[model samples]
Target: MFDMFKNNPISSIACVLPPALVNAFAKQNFYSPEQVRHVFTNELKTEHNIEYALAMFCSQLDFDALQLAVTYKELRANVAKECFGGWPRFNFDSLLDYSRQSAGAGGGFAGDGGCGDGACGGGGE
Candidate 1:
């Protein structure tokens, strides 16, 4: 690939790629270098933040190539969720407001589900 990219437009593109993207271009257990490079180049072109996400996903890769989960897509999703689960992109205050609205509206159903006779339906426990 270095020989092929020496004087090519893709060389400039490859130079700016992150290391995670660079490593994905190499041959893996059953695939050839050209095959790996072509596939990952296309994915890198299409997917946002794919190099970082794939780095998170590839930490689980084994030199032994042990098969655990089935697909790269599933593994990628799981890794991405673990990495970005608390990104804080939503308006959680709306959920808090909703909970408060339910607090006094339904016979104490907002918590504990009391019988209202103060028995708690637990043999007076």
Candidate 2:
């Protein structure tokens, strides 16, 4: 949108928008069409301009709670490494500790951890 205004500043749609709002967004320095498309699609949830789709689907046809826990642990570790620059202070074990404490303190998982097997007892073992 900034490029849209570079040629004719006064007649641009950007100019018609509230100046403060326009200025605030401009600081992000988004020059690529991909960046603009992602921001717009997230805000609108229609993905009109994006060409690619990113999705992760896990179907529990045969897996149990222990298997699901392993998947969650791997995903959390990978995200922390790739997106957060490194592992966070809390890892899978720590997360399990927190969850168990939460459950012990009156947080039940839909009356039995949502698994046929009773609520899991802490860590991702």
- TM-score of every model? 0.19, 0.19
Choose the strongest candidate by lDDT: 1
The lDDT for every candidate, in the order shown, is 0.30, 0.28
- In the range 1-125, model 1's lDDT, one tens digit per residue, is 33222222221122223233335544232333334345446644533333322323243343115343354445434322322232212122222222233233312222222223311121110
Lowest lDDT 10-mer window, candidate 2? 50-59
Instruction: List model 2 lDDT by residue over 1-125, tens digit each.
Output: 33332332211211122222223354222223334344434433554312211101111222223233245345434433322234444332332333344335522222211111222222111
What's the C-alpha lDDT at position 101 in model 2? 40
Model 2 quality (TM-score): 0.19
Question: How accurate locally is residue 59 in candidate 2, as Cα lDDT from 0 to 100?
Answer: 17
